[model samples]
Target: MKNLINYTVVLLLLVFSGCSEDLESVKYDDINPSIFPSSEADVQAIVASAYYPLRGSYGNGIHSTSENGLMFILDATTEILQGPYGVQQEASLHSYKASSTSFTRFYDVFYNKISNMTLSIDRIEKSNVNEQIKKKAIAEVRCARGLLAYELFDLYGPIVVAPLEVLKNPLDEQPLARLSNAEMVSFIENDLKAAAAELKSPAETPYGRFSNGLARMVLIRLYLHEKRWAEVEEQATAIMDMNYYGLEENYAGLWDITAPVSSKEVIWAVPADYAGTSENQWQLMVLPNNFPGRGGYGTIQSSWKFYDSFESTDIRKMALIAEFTGTDGVTYNRANPANYMQLGPIPLKIHPDAARTTALTTVDMIIYRYADVLLSRAEALVNKTGTPTQAAIDLVNIVRRRAKISEIELVNYATLAKFNEMILLERSHEYWCENGQYRSDLIRHGKFTEHAIDLNGAASQSEPYKALFPFSLAKISEGKGKFIQNQGYN
Candidate 1:
């Protein structure tokens, strides 16, 4: 008997039912209050469900892995897209137009995931769940909800439509509408604060549900985006004060997939068990020169420019890429004087699977880390000072010391512009692939357009409004007329 629980099962879990169930019955059917306790076990299951969206291939649609990689592609903007690294295909929609199908797909996916989270929160809350467990579940739900809003706010603008927008406005159907950027930020920040108050400490979450510290980390990020330097500093400092999570003695350990959870600094991620064909490592992006029926999708590669940017001595440069000696006996160092699109020295941060070379490893993708919190605090401080204060410099140096880069590279961090440059460099090196925050790093650092034009190898002009994408047509069609499409797209 073939096990039917595969990608189809994962799909059913996210969207529909296990068998031939009626659609209305499935949506309205609530979790049995008597069955689910507010115990750690029940909360564990709900937390697992929230993370499901980040691990799947819905193109950043709900919260799964595929959408996340796609999110990274979009976040990198044209810079990562063009550098012969990442999803750099010249014809790749993300590389050129701001309103490509990739954008549309992302728009739809985000809204759907938001709805899924809403369902999870509503059903779980009404259950006979434990008080603390319920609080944690709701907190995690809010964090997940804020994450969707932030991503959409970063890409589109704000929420405009009513509840119906979640149903009908997913495609190129009808009207589109969005709120101002400020409105989106305000919503995200308020929600994050709510999440923080409700969440417990990391020690309380045996299953890695997010905590108050994680909420604060995101709050710091949001405040930084809004240039609320004082608040960024305050929230970040408070989180750092908790002293629950701090820099490891070795920065390399931070990237160690095999390390115990204690060695890890991750704030949130998608969990993939050995359950299905799709829920595994992101090996599809790396590996080169087809080896023994090996599936190296090779969809994403690092660029020459990024490789060049890393100082030859930096450990990060080595950590990000690898030269492969193919099973064919010839080593590919881009030494083949023939192949124009060189695949050498590309990212190998993740291999297909170490435990089972034939199997795809179910590794969690890191989204937020403790280092990000410290950096956010440093950023707030430096922005106000126009130069990194000694405290800020020390915070950064603490990060670099673990990378083994030494005072030569890190001690050079001084002046404000130089500090900003160093921060961006660290972000690119530290969080690039895993966090998919490269594009946000560029934009917040004021490099979105300049770097985008450079990556495309063209000086094409883009409107300031193009920064936020338009709402999906599916949203408007559901409204039947009230919703309005974003300005540039129409």
Candidate 2:
């Protein structure tokens, strides 16, 4: 069944040809919506198609146009990850212009996902499937749409809210304008809330489907970004009280394809197969060029500063490989920091699998996990109380303890500002490269610009507007002047 779900998602993606073009241009004339999705299996298939676009972000060799993948655009701009020269380096250096092609491709992929989900929702609504199944299918589609909208907001600031109606009537020429940030947030919240009520709990949800817990996780992040402390605390607390999730005992085992499903830690994960069928390209992008198996392109390397941040006792540091036994069975040590250009530390967070090579590994990309929930709760509590509560300190300690690091005392962070800083640092170590959370985490903590300036030296402190990406010229043109680029990029 798991294989079927993965195979179905891949098949649907092919059947739709990834739907990269404008929704208006997508020729739906061949199929009658009136008779489509006429059965339970049909409705489920449409719902399954909605999940296919998530593969777009990591370049499943089908949907994503840019070889660099969306994760590069998201993580390269942060302090910890550095990419080889060009747009990736520019992204890391914060030197990217409005015309940056990689960012533009990433922007397109996201909108394409939203467009696909919108059409799925429309078809599900018109289908004559059993009422309960139809409603559940719609809920699942909205959950995907809501999460993608949240990602767009995180990347591009404010965007048109899905525009399902506009997409439904492609002939209408009135251009869609970007919504206000508040409006966008509200729209995302509405979708997530509605989905959360109708979706199954984590325990009951099928392996690949979105669950109620996943929707709440998205809400927790949204509230955190909005600085709505009370809401963050409320949402985080609800997830914690569910008592159905907990941190994986071994930090490194979480990425093992065999372990992710059985682990209590994972809230929601994008499933993949290690036999080289359904795969994630992150390992291929980040592994050192000289290492074993299918030698990676050496595109993404960890920054020295990030390597230095880890304490000696931290078990999580094992995930960051400075040395490895290659496929030739020879030990290779990383070059000196001065020679980092040729041989630097590469992140093995998505550990290489012995069974297969060629950049396709079965490691499931984890979207939300219990450890993040605990950290979010800790941050929310500190923000809401203006001081670190014992409960907040305890939550932080739980994650720290799992990492084999010393527990942080509340007294060490006497001020709310100091406590918040510690929380952000803990997150940097705990969640680096697990879905683009580090980038958003830095922005939320107001450290993004400062970190970029410190690391790249080429970045200017005055360019705080780089926090939000510029609207691609194509997107603006699509809107016919209704879409304005972010202020500074203009």
- What lDDT tens digits, residue by residue, belong to model 2 across residues 180-277? 98898998999899998999888776555678999999998899889898888888888878878888788888887563666678887766654333
Identify the leading candidate in terms of TM-score.
Answer: 2
Extract clashing residue pairs from model 2: 274-362
**lDDT (Cα, tens digit) per residue for candidate 1, span 38-130:** 556555456555644544443333434332444445534534333243334532223334345555666665555665566566656777757
> Candidate 1 regions off by >4 Å?
1-48, 57-71, 75-99, 119-133, 161-177, 250-259, 291-295, 335-344, 351-359, 408-414, 459-466, 473-482
- Listed in order, each prediction's TM-score against the native is 0.79, 0.89
Cα RMSDs, all models: 6.8, 5.9
